[model samples]
Target: MTSGRDRLIEAATRLLTESPDREPSNRELCDAAGVAAPSLYHHFGTKEGLLDAVVDRAFGAYLKRKRGMLRTGDLVADFAAGWDLHIEFGVQNPVLYALMYGTRATSSAARTADDRLRKALHGLRDAGLLRIDVDTAAAMTTAMAVGCVTQLNRERRRADDPFATAMRSTLLETVTGLPASPSEPEFAARALVAHLEATSEGFTAPERALFQQWLRTIADTTRTVQDGQHQ
Candidate 1:
């Protein structure tokens, strides 16, 4: 049997899907759920809280699917799939996507999604396949993905729209330096940092920390030189 809380969520989800451009009224939600106003407050505290729960439930299911397929050994491919999945989810659930990520404050589900991306980027860094550090790469990739979703929502485009495809390729190439090998010293330095992070048998904690900083300097210096060359 569907509990009153579940009914409210289901009604809100339906209403959001039905009118992606509008928010459902609390009275409308209560009417659809066949529950009183007090029922909603009792279950979710407020309308915004109910919306958050709806977004959480929907996005949690989406993340479950993404997590299942994001670790097939090839981290770059995994990242690409994850990107596609994000855009696809946005296309399918524009209102939910907006609720999940369009706010000034980050949602818990959004943070979890970013953590997954960072974990994959860490793997790529360990394999010497990333030109930038993990955090920078994650930020760039996420910014691109979110911008793409926002654009698609504005334009009412499909997930496989050419614009999305081009953005994905461009973002990946810039962040990961794909097709062009990570042959630079920066890539080597990043790989070494990853290695040092894993093995700590010989050095004390402070020593390991200092050595990692040195490796990061090497990586950052190479990146600076490359940037200067580009300009």
Candidate 2:
């Protein structure tokens, strides 16, 4: 029971995520969304307008999730929560993350989208919710979290191995400038779950199933790797 505008936005979101390299024709998107071409123009005006709307919708959802999970009263807790959400978003919706933030085609939109995240981090700093300088700490924290998620994605795709534990250890050490410890693993798992629960919208049932399969594969790989290490 989606309206024409809603259907158009949904179609645009999918195209933006799945095919950002080239612009999708209005006709194609309309066909995909089961809407007519005139309805797209009536609602969005033009292709660029449609793209802008798509970016807005995508980043709007992301910001809403981040804001919802704000750990404003404590520095370490806030950092941990933010990092967990970042990793979870990247893992659950790699395509959307890449399209919105990591792709060259959407670099302008990415920067615009990033401003929202930067603002949240800055607010945390203003509230003394973080111990480090706002800009440096935000950059470092985001880089480490995104790197961990990207590495996890690569490992999952290759079915090569699970480096979640090692990545979590490294991230804790690098971002917080803390020594890695045994307790980090439990923290990382908690963070992963938090992120997944927060930002896993726009995912179709099929994509969710694929991700679940990958998770199982990674779990099996982790067990094998841990056993080998012990031996």
Candidate 3:
């Protein structure tokens, strides 16, 4: 049997995710989780705490799935696998994503969850998994995944349809800088790692002064490129 705290978190996640208009009241959360009102207060202290717990659970699931697929094999293949997992999660748990990203609750738990994801991505960058520069690459990848899922959610399409196939292809191509074919390896993972290491080592200060400078340069260049595309 799940513990009361676990049940509370699970219940809060469901309530918060499914409620589109406003935050659920504590009483509503208690009913959803099958816990008594005092049990909710005893475990979380307040509704905010319950929300934090929910976010933690959601992000925990996301990181667990992300880390599980990382292997020392081909980085490109690993990336594709990771992306697939992300899309899968987005589809399966739209409510979780909506709650995590949409809610305006203030709890240390929520910040902790957000920080955990950032640190995981940072480690991936340090290990040479993702591109070092953060122009729109990270944001764009998120956008694509969320956008694809959003469309599917709106259309109420089956998961095993052409839309999913095409969205996965598009995401893989855009994020990895590779073609959507099985035969070609983009080497983006390798290049990203090398770029991050070089940028880090070239820094004159341990505070990452040089790396920050380089990132700014890249960000500016990326913006110019994007503007040109618009023009």
Candidate 4:
């Protein structure tokens, strides 16, 4: 058996999700939930209270999935997926996504999502994929994602739209300074790591691992410095 509160939430969810145009009036909500007007007041105190609950229930899953993303070590691929999910969720739940991020005051859930982005950017830095510090990368990534989603939500981008991919690719290229194709230096270094393993390189597995690590540091730094001088 559910209480009046749950019933009201369920009804509101069904109605609002069906259409985020506007909130149902108290009478409509009460009628849909089979409860009295005062029951809503008794349970939620005010219409805002009920709306807050509705927002929480709607966005909870989005937050969870955002926090859990990109477990694979492929930072580039992971961030691309993250961008897709952000745009998709926003496009699907415009009213709620806007309400959550539309405000100057971010909710706790939003902050948590922001933290996850920073952590992922840091992972990119660890992989020698970042051109800037972790903080700058995270800020740039967050800003770009929010801007993309907000604009796409306004434009009502479809699943097949190329705008999301275009914007994501552009932002990543600008921030990371990576070519559209794989970096030649990084490619050569990765091939060397594989060759070392394939030929046994007169070393054990652990020794090969350490050698590859140092090689990556040198190759990444060399690229970074060269890219800087050309700017």
Name the runs in model 1 displaced over 4 angstroms: 180-231
Top candidate by TM-score: 1
- Ranking 1 against 4 by TM-score, winner: 1
Give per-residue lDDT, candidate 3, residue 210: 51
Q: Per-residue lDDT for 136-187 in model 3, tens only?
A: 4555656676677777767776544578667767755664555554221222
Q: Which lDDT value does model 3 have at 197?
A: 41
Tens-digit per-residue lDDT, 174-213, candidate 2: 5456554432333444343334445567677677556545
lDDT on C-alpha atoms for all candidate structures: 0.77, 0.61, 0.59, 0.69
- Check candidate 1 and list the clashing pairs: none
Candidate 4 residues 1-231, lDDT tens each? 999999998888777777767778988889999999999999889877787776676667676555543233447755666666677677777777766666512656567677777877887788888888887777777777777777887777763267766777786787677754334455345435544544565888899788878766765665576668879
RMSD of each: 13.3, 8.9, 13.7, 11.9
- Write model 1 residue lDDT over 166-207, tens digit each, in one string: 887887788778853222465445545654664577899999
Quality of model 1 by C-alpha lDDT: 0.77
lDDT at position 20, candidate 1: 75
Model 1: how far is 135 from its true place, Å? 2.5
All candidates in order of lDDT, best leading: 1, 4, 2, 3
Whichever of 3 and 4 has more lDDT, that candidate is 4
Candidate 2 segments exceeding 4 Å error: 15-23, 70-73, 103-132, 157-176, 180-231
| Best model number under lDDT | 1
